[model samples]
Target: MFKFQLNAITAVKALVWTAVRRMEVKDVPTPTPQPGWVLMRVRYVGVCGSDVGGFLGKNELRRPPLIMGHEFTGVVEEVGPGVSKDLIGRLFAVNPIIGCGHCRYCRSGLKNLCLMRKIIGIDYPGAYAEYVAVPADNLYPVSDPVRGALAEPLATSMRAVRLSGAGLGDSVLVIGAGPVGALAVKLLSIGGVKDVTVIDINRNRLEWAGRWGASSTLSVTGDEALKSLRETHPEGFDAVIDAVGSEDTRGLAINAVRRGGRVIFVGLHDNEVTIPGNLIVRSEIEIKGSFSYTDEDFLKAVRVLESGLLDPREGWVDIRPLERGQETFEELAGTETKYVKVMFNPGG
Candidate 1:
């Protein structure tokens, strides 16, 4: 039998040369699956703020020339032997982190901290391309109406929610109304938390947060918002979620958390914020940092998406074409765009 082999496949890719390099798009190799791997036809990919910062070279969190996307969704195109062939043609959300299953973090079910962790778009090839080969372990199938690519960030919001210990009927002060924070508000409401408040300098984000379940949205340019917070939570907030990751937001979290309350830091701020450690010790305030989500988080995210609980089109996401990655990111870096979440539909 004469067999025909495919030569080259074209995919739009975001390539960042060392930090501060202009992103370029290029056609790359079509990946073939290895054992335990599945090939996906890239459908949608979300550009992250980290991708921008890394593009700026200020932090240079990712190595150069790698595809830059972690939040993505696709359909299984092919699977290697020993893999579940039934998964082909099924929609799936990509779990970017690859962990060793035997390590302390992995053993403890905290694979996000696995010593050998390889995050997609960071240490490994990523989904910002037409065809991506990933470990079958990293794929999660989705049913009808299928989950949008934005579900990844929704999962991240839930992760922060769990980390913050925000419970039903609890009061939460989210110190950033960005996509993740805004989604956090949605998750909080769905989780049955009462009286959710969102703070963001961006007026548009604040408005969006309100639509996403924020009981109160405040723009903290002065002390007026602080006064409002004081009146709302006379004692202090039950939980403070620092989603901005800025030094100012960190301080705000510390100040807003009630004695014995919990403060969860979910943002990736560049600088450090100084807080009264003695007061933290005296007040018994629990300050914790939430990293990325775990497998369980991904599963919960799948359930949430599958349930149609979150509708990104309902004021949470901005979808664009994959080829516009560069321009889109540049626009996002600007304060005027008023975007909460941006996802790329590569296949579109």
Candidate 2:
């Protein structure tokens, strides 16, 4: 078999932006796969909020000079010895974090929380490059149901839904109707939740939420949402999901749920935040944090994607090439369209 090599692994990098503060883009090297790894040509990659944070310098110092993109899909062009022959030419989804299974986190079946986990696009090189090297184990061959590029985010949203503890007929509330939140809404609905209300300040985002299966979309402040909570369900919701990490949203979640309702926080803000713990103390609310996804969740995410349920075209995504990723992410913060997901198409 051919050991694939790219002519160049140019990447779109994020540099500081002062004016609109929408960062500039830089191109860097492709990469070479070493032993126990597979070489891929990125096909489709999702530009997630974390990627935006890096560009906006929210996650700046944590990792600058980093190739931005984690939720991605690609084709294996070459595989080193010890990798399965079935991988080459196969469409595959990459698991950014290939955990060290012996660690306590992994041992607890929580590989996503592994302290030494190798996070692609974070700790190591990622898909924004023309060529990316991933451990053989991180590659899952794509089938008809799920496309390779979309698997990562789907897995992420799936994990959030799974950890949410929201059951069927549960009234759910998702704040910040961003891309991930919208995806969560879809997952919650599919998981048998009877109602899922999404709140966002952006009118377009609120409208976009409807496509993601939001039972209702509201453009209300946290204080107002609380007031409505009284008339709607005084006890609060069965599950309240904070998709964006904002103190206001977090507080609303605390004050808006029933005493025993579950709250799942998935969004990531650069800084630390404080919440109403006293409310939690009195209500005995169940608060859980969700990050990334599990293998089982990944498989299920693939099933959902393969089921033809989510068509990004039908939804609100604008796909660009890898070269435009930085601009696209930065532009997203200012877009007037009803956009939720912005993707990159790294070509052959």
Candidate 3:
């Protein structure tokens, strides 16, 4: 397949003088799977907020001339030596994180926190292509390609709720209405949290939240958000999830949670944020930071999604062809749209 031309949307670096940023499709040679790896015929890929950030050069961890897509579904088209051939025709949702198995975190099943972790699309090539190679261990079989593309983000939401420890009848506040935040709200509701409030500056997103599982939706910005929160839940929520992760949202999470309540930071929109040390110390509030998902969380996400607990097809997700990745990324970064999430069909 060396002469076979395959197309990929790759983030190419412009000269230092130019402001141009965003990936473009290029015709490249199809990759052959190495030992322990399999080549996947890319089906669907999700455009994450971080993918937008990376395209805009906002994520310091991602370098240009990369293929930036972690959430994707595909069919195994070829298997390398030592791998089973039966996987060649099966569909899968690819887990993008490849952890060094010897790390302490990996041994504890917290591979998300592995010290020597390499993420697909960021550290290596990813599925924003006609075909890409991934380790066989990272692929999980699934039935639907669209829903399969959501496994990574759903696993992230699952990790956030697990870290928050919000229980039955607990009052929870989700601080964003984007895909992850919306999924958090839905999962919390499925976990039996009744009084869930979702806040965002976008009215359309807030509406989506309400439809998903939130009992209340607040469309507020800056200080007004805190005021609205106080007015609605005078005593504050039992747990606050900061899914936007801006300085303002961090502050809101700190002040909006009841004394002794938990606060989970799930968003990485901002590089750094300041919080009131005195408030956290005095209230004895528990503040936790959640990263990506563990293997267990990823598995649970697949099961929950398969059970139809939360379906992205119900109108929360939008699909576009992979060729439009640059335009879609620009649109998503340039302005806030009604779409809570957007997925790209790479096979098209």
By lDDT rank, best first, the candidates go 3, 1, 2
TM-scores, all models, native as reference = 0.89, 0.88, 0.92
Clashes of 2: 4
User: Best-fitting candidate, measured by TM-score?
Assistant: 3
Q: How well is each residue in 247-291 modelled by candidate 3, as lDDT tens digits?
A: 889999999999999999988877877899999999999999999
Clashes of each: 0, 4, 0
| Candidate 3: clashing pairs of residues | none
State the lDDT of candidate 1 residue by residue for 49-162, as single tens digits.
Answer: 677667766444576766777888888988976898999988888888899899999999899989888887787667777777788988877763225576678778889998
RMSD of each: 3.9, 3.8, 3.8
lDDT of 2 by residue, 266-319 (tens): 877545678888889888999999988877777777777777778776757777
TM-score winner between candidates 1 and 3:
3
Worst 10 residues of 2 by lDDT: 12-21
Tell me the whole-model lDDT of each prediction, alpha carbons only: 0.77, 0.73, 0.82
Q: After superposition, how far is residue 60 of candidate 3 from its true place, in Å?
A: 1.8
